[model samples]
Target: MRTNKQVYRSGPAATKFAQAVKVGDALYVSGQVGMDESGHIPADLAAQMQLAYVNLEQVLAQFDASMAHIVDEVFFVTDMQDFMSDAAAIYAARQAVYGAEPAVCHSLLGVSALALPALKIEIKCVACVAHESESHRAKASR
Candidate 1:
């Protein structure tokens, strides 16, 4: 069976689409932007990247998953050159969360603009529910 859910915060505008859907063991996360729970974008690229990842984390957490469960990621940025540092920072953060495996399937794209003016980065991810046999899940429980 499949399940769908919309994620939102108190003061933020309602999400335009479903934040995540779970089909069997996999979770598909919708595109997440660099905005806070109140929908305000941060000023710097690094901050925006952090915020975007934070949003992604929130969605994943709903499924009892974390970045360690992420098997794929799609990243979008307005200016590739200007955002490389921020991208690297996000990558580092992912390394901390997922160790090495979650870095494998990643795509980066240069986009004209995001849905919001202040959003410089957006990210989407796909993750699996932690199986009892998974090593990562064992580690997380410790």
Candidate 2:
């Protein structure tokens, strides 16, 4: 079997990892952190979580995909205690981006540390998209 591989870079100063990769119909997004184009990493858990999703959005858009195209996601949080206490608002902000689309499969994990100590959360997702005209978002809504 043959597979096509593609890579995405957030910046010229980016790390040695592709933000997102497209192989056939699956788009594998790397763990997006709270940082943005301006090197901003929010200290607040909710803000960090929101920014992480935003980062995910930027990477996904490169492949003509959006959060709506996401089928599954795994979130790595540095502090489970803090996240569990403020889960509601964080989830709400995340939903604001995904909108009213059907729920995407999700998992929350507690980790000792992330790429940065200031980084509270990192999000990664797998999006199954169409090879042709229709996309994952268009197909899932039907």
Clashes of 1: 0
lDDT of 2: 0.78
Candidate of highest TM-score: 2
Candidates' RMSD to native: 6.5, 5.9
- What total of clashing residue pairs does each candidate reach? 0, 0
Q: Please give me the total number of clashing residue pairs in predicted model 2.
A: 0
lDDT of 1 by residue, 18-124 (tens): 67766667777888888886668888877787778888877777667788888888888888888775556767775665656465488999999998788888888
Off by over 4 Å in 1: 1-15, 85-90, 97-101, 130-142
Estimate the TM-score of every prediction.
0.74, 0.85
